[model samples]
Target: MMSLNQVCPYCDITKINKDIVSVDHLLPKASFPVLSIFPDNLIVVCKACNEVIKGETIYLPIAHPCYEEVSRHFTFVIKENNNNKFTIEIATNSKNSKLINQKIYNFIKLFKIIDRYEKYMTAELQDYRTAVRTPNKCVFIELGQLTLLPPNLLLKRLFHSKFQPCFSY
Candidate 1:
């Protein structure tokens, strides 16, 4: 069941190799043992995300996947560096609400999402540059391929402007 997911929703680790995914209790089983039995409380995440990033720490405002579609409130800003690499930053879509913005920030911090992405971006950017530079190669930038990287904006802009006409089917 865990392998069915292409990437970890929290940390965005691609499930390419072994089964490095594990079940994580969103509310923490140590805190709410009764909810441990509830399927809704369980979220399948990467091993690093479950054990290292989140650990036993609890988060308020509950970005529970079952109840709240909290991800829509966040946006990833991708900036191209002069060295042909990219830097990614997460920004909250909700500018007016402090509480909503704080929740978004806490979620990012708790999972160390940016740190993880930064590590992967160097390699992914290199691959991206190579794919784009190669001629007649249809570079399909699927949203699923990107996962938490960018839902829409980043690659779309890159292909249009930087890559100078790449094909996506």
Candidate 2:
């Protein structure tokens, strides 16, 4: 997670505490029983992206957003309407075009990410504002070094983002 910067590649539009963090078998264990413990077949994702959205579902032969780097295949468009509500859409500027767009579209729709992200856009923006307005600039880097955490998580701890430790272990 630290390597991925602690953000679930799928739908980490909101802050994720450890309890909801889970391991996803890129190839579902139910389908490929042999790959259940295969390190290469695993991807760590938040509970929502794992259980709630993709449980036992397979999107293989497409992009897994990890080794495949979905961001390279697509970008996001954050649109703000007159009502100040934000909407996120997958961009159509993929160098590979059609198939990539469709894959990302399917992933987003599967997770209802536009709606989920819209629900927390304000809070995310608020956190960003707070970070920009913080009196200490060096502290973020300092904290990251001290905790060995990634930038996004450093921001979460520094700004006290909406997270409660839900992990039992």
Provide backbone clash counts, one per model: 0, 0
Clashes of 1: 0
Which candidate's TM-score is highest? 1
lDDT of all predictions, in order shown?
Answer: 0.65, 0.59
**Model 1 Cα displacement at 156 (Å)?**
11
- TM-score (all chains, Cα) for each model: 0.65, 0.58
Which lDDT value does model 1 have at 56?
80
Q: Give a tens-digit lDDT track for model 1, residues 1-169.
A: 5455455666544452356767888888899899988988788877888887787887786566546455677777666678866677876774528887777677788887777667665566666767766676666554234435443344344332343336554
How would you encode candidate 2's per-residue C-alpha lDDT over 1-169 as one tens digit per residue? 3444366867655345577677888787888999999887787778888888778876534566666565455444555567755565655453676777777666667667667755655465445444544564322232114123432353355344543323223
- List residue ranges in candidate 1 displaced over 4 A: 1-6, 16-18, 81-85, 127-169
